[model samples]
Target chain A: MSNLMTNYYEAAAVILFGIGFMNLLLAKNLIKKFIGLNIMDTAVYLFLAAKGYITARAAPIIAQGTAARVEDYINPVPSGLVLTGIVVSVSVTAFSLALVQRLYKHYGSLDLDEIMKKAKKEEKV
Target chain B: MTAVNYIQNIPFFSIFLAIFGGIVTPVLGNGKTAQKVNLVIVTVIGILSAVLLVHLWQREESFTFMMGRFPAPWGNELRAGPLEALLALCFCLVMALTLTGGSRFLQKDVLPGKQNLYFTMIYLLLGSMLTLIYTNDIFTAYVFLEINTIAFCAIIMAKGSGESIVATLHYLVICLLGSGLFLIGISLLYSITGHLLMENIQQAILDLVQTGEYAFVFAVVIGMIIIGISVKSAVFPFHFMLVSAHSVATPASSGILSGLVLKSFIFLNIKMFYCVFTIDLIRSLKITNVLFVFGLMGMVVGSISALKERRIKHMLAYSSAAQIGYIYMGLGLGNHEGMVAACFHILAHAITKAMLCICAGGLIEASEGNVGINSLRGAGHRNLVAGIGFTVGGLSMIGIPLTAGFISKLYFATATIYSPQKMVITLLTLAISMILNAMYFIPSAIAIWSPVDKKAKIPKPSRAMQYAIGIFIVLNVVLGIYYAPIIDMIEIGIQLLES
Candidate 1:
């Protein structure tokens, strides 16, 4: 129980991840699906951020006029990784949105099932 | 500088050259010009990596080059061993051939204005695959996985049809889910091991294993990584996206996606098994057992699905899933020979499937865009080269003697001899899959060759395409015949990988 409490952030993040994954899977609207994807990405970011943070530790920036020590700061790797993740997620979301926009333009529907029906009809013709 | 010093730069050069080609491609403005540039770039990389393979084989050693001045486990790194170089060489070779072979379709299928952009994506795709092959950092692999996914999605939709567009959207969604899983897995791993470099992580994992702590977390991490990659690679149950995306795309896109892209992820898994967790650890955890079950299911189920597909391209796509199953089956055997078999199958399947896609494109062209198997009757008579190519490719797929596929199957069978526990299941699946392979491939092969009632389009595949298909056929036969040296090379490569 103490271990679970101590890692509550990770627990919350995992739950968020599961919810986002479910939404991504079950949502009919393409935009909503992408929103779910974004949520999932955010959960990942949270998990990574929590992993990188250490209680009472300073940020990774080197202090001026003081000798640098490993103990002075939290691990900066995950922070850099989080930045990379944000960039990746932004691009992915933008790309997915652009695709969804094109899909909407083509079929005039945001629902996947409707678009698929229209596409099948189009193919039959 | 000495030859060794110069050889060390080949991996770096070969990767960035493709990216450089991609960057400069849009300036060319003409799709034709961009394509010519792309071919030149792939060819150059092919030659460079081929040379690197020879150099590495002779040296019998692997080298890691640090990006900029940063050291290991921190800065980015690229490692080249015999295996990496060999796979890179083959990828470059296959990409060049695929582009050349499918250039006509590219010209016809893609929008005129987007042709240069199409070539740019191809260049980037090549760069990303090479990066995936050579990267020593796990995060670098994940980043390139996204790049690869995006580039592939763009190419799939390059055909500019509603079907292709819709297919691309689905593909993008599924691929994002995959990469999202992969990213979280990497974060979890980094949190535990505090190292992103594969070698350092392996050491940390070794210590963790020895201490017998956090075993549950460890299993979750491996499971996440494996499932993420399996999803992307279209293993069995996750193969729904492959059929649509691969079938709807242009022949070039189909060939590259089905042939090379899937194989790269599998290669990454192999690397993780060998370099990240080590084989003994993986086996001890019984992860291979789970993979083994999935492998058998994919083999049997994928082949059965292929048998039921009506469209020629869809059938080929399903067969690819089955072949992926074969590779995974070999991996799941959990022996050194099985790994080698998996690698050989990778090579064999890359060549054979790419040829099959290009040949199918040619047949479709000759038949005036009808992809139905029945409609393809006498497609052989119209485009004889494509007909012969498809026959040979199909034959290879069925494990006919004197083809690359036969050698791989033989290797897999021999590999099963080492693991008696898996022997019965492995052999039974192999036998069943082989028959299943023949059941679909034979009919399709015969259908393309059979007589048709109507007149067929006499579209001759272009000179470049003819040359590309010719080289693919020749390479297939060569590998089938002269496999000893290649297998020896792969063995040496695997040794280098482990060391």
Candidate 2:
């Protein structure tokens, strides 16, 4: 219980992940599902960023004229990873939106179930 | 250039060439030109990988190439052992052959303006697959996983139909979910171990295990990684999306997706099992039990689903799911020979399924775009080469006496001898799945060859396509006959992997 309080950020990230995951799974609207995906990605970023941060340490950048020690700063790798994750998430979101646009034009609906039914009807025809 | 000094650079060179080929393809402006370039790039990579494999075999060693100046822990690195080289070689060969054999359909199915982009996606897909096989950094693997996912969706969407687009959407969504889970898993791993390199992580994990600390977190991380990969590769239950996507994609796209992409993910899974978390640890964690149950279910349920499917491509897609079940079952057996069986099955399925998908495409073309099994009457008569190809692939899938599938099954059976607890279940599932495979495959094989009331006039596949299919048939027979050498190589590869 003390550990949970100490690592509150990670716990919050986990809760956010669960919420985003459930929304992505249960949402009927395609765009809403995509929004859920974005939220999930955000939760991951939050988790990663929180892991990279240390309470007492400074940012990875060293100040001018300062003799720097490795322990004086937070871990830089996870921060770099967060940046990469964001780039990936952004491109994926763009691609998903483009696909949604096409789907909407074709099916006249953003609802996944409706689109699926219409596709089935078209296949039958 | 001097002697064998440059052999170590082959992995790097092949990855660069594949990706660079994709980048330069659009500038070629002509689809045919881009295709020629892509084929050339793939063949070059194939030759280079083959050379590297031979070099590694002769020296009996593996080598790591640093991406920049930094050493292992701090730098991006690629490692090529016998197993990685073999996988790279086979992937290159499969990609080249898929393109060659399915080019006719590619040209017909994809738009004139979009053909070049399609090849670009293929090149990118090949590059990412090779990276996934060779990468020493788990994070590098994750990055390439995204590339692979996007490229697969692109190729599937290249079919440019309402149905194909819908299929792509579903595939993309599921793949994103898989990668999202995988990313979070990686983040947790990094947070715990503070290293992204596989060897370093393994070292940290070993120490942590000795101390008996963070066991729950460790188990959750491993579970997330396995489940993430399984979902992406469409192991049963999560396999519903695969049927629609593979069936709706073009022939080459389906072949690549089913044959190479899924196998690469499985290979990555194998790597994680061996390199990151030792098999003993995984067994102790009881993750193998979960995999075992899923594998059993997938074998029976996937085959049953395939039997129920009426469309030829849909059946083949379902069969792919069943074959995946076989690989997972082998992995779940949690023995040395079980891993060997799994690797061999990967090769068998990659070669056989690619040939099957391409042949199905040829038959569809010969039947004037009809996809139903009933409508394929006399398709064999119309396209004799495709008919023969499909027959051979089907027989291979059914574990017929002298096919690649038979060798894989033999290995699985031999592997089961080591695990007494799993023996009965493994053998029973094998038998049941084999029967189920034959029940659907044999009839479809005969139906295609069966006579029709009115003969349909259709164009034959191009010479390149026929030649590609012919080569696959020969490779299948050869693999079946020469199983001893390949099995030995796999054993050596596994030893190198664990070391």
Candidate 3:
């Protein structure tokens, strides 16, 4: 239990992911589902960044005259990956929001259930 | 660089051409120019991919092209084996054919001003698909996967109808969730190995397998990636969104979406499994068993439901789901023969389904855009060429001995021979699915041919559309009769792919 407590960052990230995934599935409102999607994306990014960080480690950059070793700096790859992920998540959010706007226009509601009903009605014709 | 040297870089060059096309096509911004530009672009790309295929085959070894000066695990890279080249070649040709064949539908469906945007989206979608095929970097693959999803959604939206918007929203949410899961899987794998290059990642995974450490996390990652891909590829349970998306999309978009786009996700998974996880690890993990059950279920479920669909396009969409089940069945069998069948089915189904969707669209056009199967009565008589095209495509789907579908089915049957435990179930499921496939397909094919009150003056598909369909029909026959070279190529390609 104590060992798990020491890794709370990861636990938190995983929890956020679980919550986001649940929200995405359970949320009736399109906007909330979209929020859930972003939350999930954000959670993954957090996990990735957390994986790259180490206690007492300096930034990846090396100063001109400093004697440096590999362990002195945290691994930089995951940070770079996390940045890319963030950009991807941002675009996804933008795209979904645009979609939500379209949905709002077409169905006259943000409620997925109502929207689905409209879609079903439309399909019959 | 010398001209020959330039030709040697065809893989990279073709990718560049597609990206250039995506950027340039939109700027041209009109129907005439977009069509002209698109023609030039697709033709050039088709020629390039074919040339690349020949070049790679002749070389007879995998070519690893480094994207920068940085070494493995750092710099980006692209690898070309016979398999990748052949897929790119097929993708280019099918994409071009679908676009050309569906141009009339595209023009009619999309707003006049936004047609250029539609063309732009198409080029970008092709560009992204090609990127996914060639990229050896896992991170690059993910990036391109996002780009591919966005561009595909954009193509659907260019229709600018309420139904398409709803359909695109449904499609996007599903795809984003799938991709998100995939990204998390990638991130987990990266954290474990500290590597993003496919080669390095494979090496790290091999180490884990050898040591038998981190087994639980490994299994979880595997599951995540598989589920993610299953959603993207519309494997069995995750396929509810697919019929809606396809039914609402334009003919060309639907053809490309159902036929080729979905298969690329399967390709990515194949690459991941073959390139990273050894077959031993896969079997030990029992991933194959899971796939086997779901695939069998899909085969039964998809086809049975396809029988109930009233709309022509929707019925075809459901059949595609069942066909995808065949590919998964091949994957689940978990052997070289099974993998080959899956790969071959990808090619066969792409050709058959694209042809079917295009022909269905033409039939609907002949019916004055009535989508219901009732509207299809005597549609064949009115538009003889489309009727013939649809028949040819349908016959191929039925797995007739001389057609491509038979080759896939034959391969699947033979593949079942190796997996003794799965043999009975595989054969049983396959036989039942064929009957189910025939149940839905034969009735619809007959229904379309049966005469009804003739609605006259239904315009036939234009000259170009006819030629494209004719070419596709011929291609299906050629693939069926002369399958030796392709199978051999796949074998050689699979070997090189298994790094």
Candidate 4:
């Protein structure tokens, strides 16, 4: 079972993605949802980076002779792509955190359900 | 180099001007200067895209310009056809007009010190939309997708109420989820096809279909991309967040977000379905009917919800969901005419919805920000410009003859002739939704024009806003009356897209 689990990195990345997606779907608190978003972002990056990995292949280096041999090195495009994904994820996380700070300041709660109940109560006027 | 080569640089210039506007806006230290910058940026882009449209129409050719000096496999690309040019033109005109018409509201609603930030976000949003349309690289589109999402969230939160904050958070989370799913889909595609450029990916997909071993994963990727964009566009089941987000947002932001931002994704979706995977392949997979059912559900549900809602902005927002369904219906029809109708609906809906949202702002101002349906009583009488704009927009939405909305529905009606069985369903959906459209819009139109509370409370709009609304009214009428050339352009554009 352990061998099967570790045999495929793509399966691990996909499972992580499923967990993150489920968290995003079911979480009630705004902060928890933010965490869910971060988790999902990381899972995607993991999946993207895994696409570059090749068994028994060296890192993508162009040291003279082996640079001519395509099979000697892993694909570098996915690694390059992972960098871009990480940057986008960082910006989103920062902005969402700023928004959560303001939400907390206004409602005195981070839970969407509680805040909604209070907001509705306040709107009764 | 020939002059055509320089003329081909319009898309690049349009994108860079917007990026430059975004950077310089905050440093200008005031909203007034920032507004001028926004206007100037959009105007120049609009003119340039219009010029490019004429050139492309005359030449009947598409062009792709490589970024940097990198060789074919490594270089990024900007590709444009008549359709891309026309969309860029519409987006710029609508953004400029909405900004002009809603400037006063922007000054009033936004915190005084943060107005420059608002303009900054607006510019960034425009830049991202243009990039999304012109990008030939898949990764470039995803990066711009995230940028547009963040910029839109900022504009919504620029209103700064508790409700606005909550709305922004909700929209942000949803966007994150959608984009995450989209990223997974792109990775799967790249892994399978080993290509990121759209044309290469298309060829790879064609070859993959021939081999037929990875069919399940291919279908999953297709579903993921469609669902991802559907979430972004607020198609049917994902529409619950749209009403709150659009309504809580300031009127100008609401206008731009609902009008242009959502359409950008739909345009991308059409490109994906048409360019990335030919409609024939999509049809073979039998996903066309699924889109039709979802579109039908959206039309029915969105209109009925609007019929029950009383707030004018919420009603308008719900109507947007329904209008998006109309575009989807066109897409799901699975013919060239259906694609044309969908694209036409994109333009018509953008102009009408922006005009309506901006005019709604005027009505709210006249009523001292009372958003209730009845409070709009005599709002038209009070603010004559708001009254006229609202009536014209409403009529167009309800599909009156000689309006752009009616033409789109007419094209859609003809487009439905492709499938004899679905013809009845298509027409029935249009007729019922139009009635539902009238049920909500007519009442509000009457409420605005009714004579009970005719006293003018809100001051006359600023000169700029008045000019903006005036231009919008003329533009809508022109789009309706002079639609033949536009239709021809879409035909040529679709031809370019097809090949």
Root-mean-square deviation of every model: 1.2, 1.1, 1.6, 1.7
Q: What TM-score would each prediction reach against the true structure? A: 0.98, 0.99, 0.97, 0.97
Worst 10 residues of 1 chain A by lDDT: A17-26
Candidate 4 backbone collisions, by pair: none
TM-score of candidate 4 against the unseen true structure: 0.97
**Candidate 3 - CAPRI tier?**
medium
List runs of model 4 lying over 4 Å from the truth.
A1-7, A63-68, B453-456
Instruction: Considering only chain B, report the TM-score of each candidate against the true chain B.
Output: 0.98, 0.99, 0.97, 0.98
lDDT values for all models: 0.91, 0.90, 0.86, 0.88
Q: After superposition, how far is residue B371 of candidate 3 from its true place, in Å?
A: 1.3
Looking at model 3 chain B, report the run of 10 residues with the lowest lDDT sum: B1-10
Can you write out model 4's per-residue Cα lDDT over A23-59, one digit (the tens) per residue?
8877887778878877887887887777788889988
Q: What is every candidate's C-alpha DockQ against the true complex, given to 2 decimals?
A: 0.76, 0.76, 0.68, 0.71
Regions of model 3 farther than 4 Å from truth: A63-69, B1-8, B452-455
Q: Write the per-residue lDDT of candidate 2 for residues A92-114, one digit (tens) a residue.
A: 88988999999999989999999
lDDT-better candidate, 2 vs 3? 2
Off by over 4 Å in 2: B1-4
